[model samples]
Target: MATPVSGLCSLKNKVALVTGASSGIGADVARLFASYGCRLALTGRNMEALQQVTDKCVERGLDKDEILMIQADFEVESDVRKTAEQTIQKFNQIDVLINNAGVYLNDSVENVILENFDRVFVVNVRAPLLLTHLLAPYLIKTKGTVVNVSSIVGRVSMRGLLTYSMSKSAMDHMTRCIADGLCFD
Candidate 1:
């Protein structure tokens, strides 16, 4: 027998924070959530792109104030912390945390510069860790869920993207550990 969907998944009156909301899968996810009536906090380094996505959310019947855009580089810890703090202040609670901010250095470690690898780690791994740490307490208060954007490379090895894959491997393991820890009685 198939199970019926619950109203809890409707996302109505819920608040979601999506990093890397400017483009790609993150943008699409934000749109889908908006269609389900979720108020969104969209973050990206590109102000124009973030506003464009927010505009679409408003057009889709989300209130003008329902969408908040934080334009900051996810590689910075201060920016990550501020994004979470501002979202909590605006929405009073966050129903979902989408750690969609990430980078793909499409090169092997042999050819990849040290600085480039560091930036990839900062954006892909460190940023999500810091953001989740900041939001864990708030999420606990609401029993909220977290959605992390990880790549298939984490499961299947590829020719390039060695560091990127490693970071995602760490993220996948972290997700499992967190899920285990957050499972309630």
Candidate 2:
């Protein structure tokens, strides 16, 4: 029998690891997921901002123990690995991984420096790929979902954002490749 959409979408007891949860879309996603009864492992570079989001989630009905806030800079490989390890250690399993951390460097093609371009790619594209690789085994074990947030600029390029746009475009391509590979498995 086909399950009802409500039953299918219910996040009760699911463990979600949301990156960039300190602000904006990531913060909002963490709040909504918590409201749906999912245990959360929130990560970002800003400890204060992440704590505020965690407080908001607690107010939304999740228990204090149901949330784990890890302050991590995605650009750092050790931080990325530690974040994943801590989440797995806390929850034992991860049912959802939201890769929403990204960097935006506003520079035209001529003005963009190699360092700035590398930073954008490292945070926006490489970090997500690394996280996905690290968490793929858990995700496959539980048939969990991985959501990689990309920008509209990836589809339609914008002026003065060459590096940012390029990074997001790589992210979009990586998403497509992962989706295709998943279908075969």
Q: Quick one: best lDDT, which candidate?
A: 2
The Cα local distance difference test for each model comes to 0.86, 0.90
The digit string of per-residue lDDT tens for model 1 on 1-185 reads 11324753568889999999999988987887887788999999999999899888877678888898999798888899899999999999998999998988888857978888889889988898888888888898888899889989988889987888888998898889889888422
Which residue pairs in candidate 1 collide?
A: none
Residue 152 accuracy (lDDT) in model 2: 96
lDDT of 1: 0.86
Candidate 1, residue 184: lDDT: 28
**Relative to the unseen true structure, what is the C-alpha lDDT of residue 151 in candidate 1, on a scale of 0 to 100?**
88
Off by over 4 Å in 2: 1-9, 183-185
lDDT of 1 at 156: 82
